[model samples]
Target: MKHKQAGLSLIGLLIVAVLLAFVFLIGMRTVPVVTEYFAVKKIIHAIAASNPSMDETTADIRRDFDKRASAEYVDSVTGQDLAVYKHGGQFEIGIEYSRKIPIVANVSLLLEFQTDAKSNGGR
Candidate 1:
């Protein structure tokens, strides 16, 4: 007669638990940045959908971005930081920014995010 084993041993379970904990720790540090990007992207989409005139100047765009950024809680970039230009009667708004996520003492992760929005009329 042979007895069969169907469960993970102590060492195997320990390894699995450690791996899960590591993943969770990293996710906790990184999830917020991803969510913030979505918020900024939403604001961009909103502005694009509103059909802002191409004649608006950089200051005008920055002012509008400030209002929307405050409402959306987007602190990463402002209109002044964005690269705004017009191409074929379509406004292009773009930003390149980076986020620092701290995991442990002197250990951190740097993430770069870039997003853009274009006027609907141009499309």
Candidate 2:
């Protein structure tokens, strides 16, 4: 007589579960930074849109950005790190920053993001 087999043996299921947990751990560690990046971008866009005249000096813009960033709890990048410029009578703001996240012991992840926003222009 012959016997039949089923899908996903106990060992296989355990392995899959472990892999999933590892991935979830990584996600849990990285999600906050990613969301913060988006928040920073949104803030920049909002500032650009609000000051369409592009007459604000770089210092003024940086101060405004610092205020908003602090309110939003953005610590990775600061207003001083921003490249504030005007071109063709339009205001543009750009930021470059890196975040290092620790996954497991002695193993870490490094993420680098570069984002820019223009006055009254879609990012």
lDDT of each: 0.83, 0.88
Each prediction's TM-score against the native? Answer: 0.84, 0.88
Candidate 2, residues 86-121, lDDT tens digits: the string is 887778889999999999999999999988888863
Which stretches in model 1 have alpha-carbon errors above 4 Å?
121-123
Model 2, position 99: C-alpha lDDT score? 95
Q: Please give the clash total of every predicted structure, in order.
A: 0, 0
Clashing pairs in 1: none
Mind sharing the TM-score for model 2?
A: 0.88
lDDT (10s digit) by residue, model 1, range 29-106: 888888888888888777777767867776787788889999888877887887878777778787889999888899
lDDT of 1: 0.83
